[model samples]
Target: MAERAAEKAYYRFLVLFFNCLLTFGSYFCFDIPSVLQEQFQGNLSCPNGTHYNGTGHNGTTECVEGLGMTPEEYNLLYAIYAWTNALVVIVAGFLIDKLGNRFGVFVFSFLTVLGSSVFALGSHFRGTPYLLPLMLTGRLLFGSGNGSLTIVQNRITAIWFKGKELALAFGLTLSFSRLGSVLNFFFTQQFESRFGIQWTLWGGTLLCVLGFVSAVTVSVLDKVGMKQLGLDGVIQQESKKVRVQDVRQLPLRYWLLVLTIMFFYNGVFPFVADASKFIQDKYPGYSQREAAYIAGAVYDSSLILSAAIGILIDYVGLRGLFAVGCAVLTLPAFALLAFTFVPPLVSTIWLGITYSFAAASMWPSIPLVVPQATLGTAMGLATSVQMIGIGLSNVIVGKILGTKSSELKIPLWRWQNMMVFMLANTIACIIVAVSLNIIDKKEGGTLNRSTKRSPTEQVAGQPADTASLLNDVDDERSIN
Candidate 1:
């Protein structure tokens, strides 16, 4: 009894630790760019006491003089980052399957630490043209770690939680990650103002180190928990003999649900990175630092609301609840973009609220459709598809902003274009939601028929050997 209690405590600790580690890393996803802009400002310091009018150490300078890159260049860089994340998710599926979640998390966390350190070092030596390559290299490595960590988080959650509790767990985990984003909003600039951009990057490096330590601790706790539960050896042996079977296959409806998530993320993730500068450009009165604060609030607020909505998904079911959430989210997103000429503060706040509602519903619904054994693969595929949308949207928004002019013939700034792009993306999401509802109904009908069929008809429909393979897959999953 003592051992069992100790084991339960360990499992709880493992879940909390992994959730914190992943959330810390997610915060850095947006933090790095803000740090980069600060470093760019320091590097592009004026040559003399006489300040260059547009190139002075002010809010716009970070975007114009510091980065040296035009809007198009920055967009391309962001696309690369998004694409790298997508590839990492796809690769991590196989890596977790082979290495197990513990080993995979450790290896990936170590890579993140290294990548962040390199990025910090590169920021300090920005005079060298080589810094760009080094920074990109670091981002690529970090992306891999990010992908691996995502897969591991979902797998671990599926293992430790069940039913509606799992949805809450997932939602709460996301909420912590949003907390990181909130920290990034205020702290990144504060760090840059205090020590320098290098120190800011170093801060992320330190977080990565902490993540590595937490991952190792979780691995140890996981072993203890498994042994106490009498599942350690059983899981290992079963993993070796595991095979893909028809019953284990995810339905097409599941893929549609994933697609909806992909569309939502496509708008949200890139916006997190780009919105600060975009807002500053559009509003003009607000400083970049102020914009960053608002942007963080926007992202973090959604996470807070999402946790509540995630619980709602458990009671309401995905088909109607998620679809309605997506539909409602579109209204604010479109309103913000369509009224671009108006004061943006109100719209920004509304957009933030809408986004939170959609996200809270969408992410929690994934595990309901996919079983544990194949959860990693399903999430990987879903994330990869999301990245594709993110990458494309970044480029498209960049082009639209860089090329188009407003009604007055003034060139529409990048941020304004981004808002327009987000509005359009939200509209696309509505269509995806409608399609998903249709697919869900069809899948439900099919499952009902399959379950109600006579035993002889079920046996005759599939060969005896194939039916046995299906049973084995289900049995192994049930053993958990």
Candidate 2:
């Protein structure tokens, strides 16, 4: 019996490992395009150039010159992508609860593949203005898949690991996902530089296919494991009950917390996507490709370190971890923007570490407060709030750069504006962290008060080793 139990546990681990891999693979698809957008601009010839101008207008390249769209139009494209992703997060939470993780993974994987296929097709037909609409459609579909995968992956972790092991399992899962993001940053740029923009899109499409296959395989394994355990009927009954609950009315406080975290994390993505351009523009000596590489390195480094930070949080608790993360991030935010004259290597390394710590600290803290049953919903709500912040930040930053006096001819100031935004975000996060710490301390104090009783009181409440008499005493007390 013991051996069988051990074997079952091993298989469960295998299922979770593969599911995590699939979730990570899906993120690669989401990230590839943002990194490759500049290359895409070169191929299509928009008068606005492929690069984002902080103003609302696309650059004045041949393809987009007569399109009558502003940089804002292009910016809206990204906003739509972010908002769609947020919507999917909300939907995915409910769907995961209703459909079960296995079915949810399979469905979302198919949706993701379909979305990636559309995106690839749009990229191939870049000459057509209509392709823009197709691209948005693809993003919407991709969001659904991404959102579903997010919930299912968490559910898998919760089911497979429990008690002390749960935190470590979650940390490792996050680390793998971050690795995927790192790959997306570098590989997308490398592929675009080497083979042109179309290949980058195609690469994302291929990743989606791989993710789908892996998800399906894991689902099959999970079902077989369930039957072998002789708990298939119980699993079905629980799944049916899960499908009946209405999760939309979860408390406003939960949504607020989710939004606050998400909004602050926006700095990580936009910075990664545009850092190369910002760096090259600010420092005239550097090439665009070099800048992009630096930016990618920052993202990869941040993600690689996030896993370590998550484990640290499990040991030190959320308050200390959050305060440390915020403090670390504040340094780079100031250093990069305020001290623009520093060497690229020095700036990149600090910024990467800061970014890594912020993300690692924030993500792992989610499970500590959120109830296990509604973690997916909470995550979705939080992600949605974060997307709103990202969209606003992207637009505001773009506007600041667009409106800058062309007369100044300085690129460093553009990055300075971004730095100011990062600083503000960091401050907000810090305030929240401090508040959370205080709350945790108060709660801990209260719990200790409730649990700790005098030795005399404990003795008075129970008989010493007279098991039969103890039952009689308890019965007499109840009768009284």
Candidate 3:
């Protein structure tokens, strides 16, 4: 019996770990444009005597004279993903809840693969009239799949690790996802310069396929494990039909969590979309490759720190406060990057720390506020709002650059303006986080409170030793 219990514990974590691979593609694809931005805006020297240099970061590069499109057009590629995702996530979340994880993951994984393929094809037709529309269509399809990938992963974690180990599960998954982002920065340029742009996109295509395989594998294991553990029937019973009116049923704390997600991510994701280019433009001497490496440092730190912070949150139980602190830090971090001569690396480190803290504390907080039944709907809603912020911010940043005086050939001032925009976002986040903490205090500190099950509750439907074993596993935490 003891051996059986140990095996169950091991499989629980194994299944959760497998689920993390699903987001590898989405995370990788999301940042691919950042590394390739320089090349996209650069011109290919054809047989003609004219030299068409792709639009530089200043956003004023003439598209008609060069690579058939402008810098603003290239900028649209990133925003398209966010805008499409913002819309798709709500529907995908509902489907995941109604159809179950396996079906949802399977279908979306295929879409991701298809999108990547289309995107790769677009690169091959670079100078053609068809190129821009094809790439945008591909991104639209990719966004449809990528949007729900995170929400599904969260639902899986909540289902498998809820009531104990929830925060750590989320942290580990996020860490792995950020690792994909880190790897993109590290390898995107290498592949592009070594093989070509088409190959670089194909690299992302390969990752998408791998992520799909991971999702399918986990789906099978989850089904088998649920049956073996005899929790299948319980879970089935717990599943409910989510309704539109249910939004009204959520508490003030849940909405606050949503707002916090929106404001904080608005400060994070859009900034990342432009990080590599921003680095190059800000420091004129830095090469594109060096700028990519510097921008990637932020993801690197998040890759290393996310899981550790998650573990710390599990033990310390001050999630709300940690989130607030991280939000406040974003102001100074972006300020230093924009307003001062501080090394870009230094700003990235601070921003990376802030990023990890927000993710580690924020995601896990969702399960506490919503019931297990409606977890999918709640996650979807939050993700939709977050994506809207991300989408709009990308467009706004590009517009800001476009408005600058065209005579300033090197628009170093644009980076400063971008930083100002991010700083304002962080300021808004601080206000939201403070409000969330106050509400947490009123709600008996749910945000910081670790759960404890009653003696009767712990053993109500399980073997005596089995119940105790699970409790022992979570012993580091209070028994709630």
What does the lDDT read for residue 32 in candidate 2? 68
How do the residues 1-480 of candidate 2 rate in per-residue lDDT, one tens digit apiece?
642452355776687678777767667776664454444333344454543322222322222111222334444556666777677777776666656678788888888889888877776665578767877788778877876676677766655553234445666776677677778766666666567666777777887788888888888876776565544554455455543243565543344345446545665655654565566556555544455566666666666676676556545445334544565565565566456567665666666676655555555445444444455666666676777777676676667555422221235666787777766776676666555555545544211111123334323432231112223334556798
Estimate TM-scores for all models: 0.82, 0.78, 0.88
Off by over 4 Å in 2: 1-9, 43-74, 226-257, 403-411, 445-480
RMSD of each: 6.2, 8.1, 5.2
Return the top candidate by TM-score: 3
Predicted structure 1, TM vs. truth: 0.82
Sorted on TM-score, best first, the list reads: 3, 1, 2
Please provide the root mean square deviation of candidate 2 (C-alpha atoms, Å). 8.1
What's model 2's lDDT at 312? 61
TM-score of 3: 0.88
Q: What is the lDDT of residue 320 in candidate 3?
A: 92
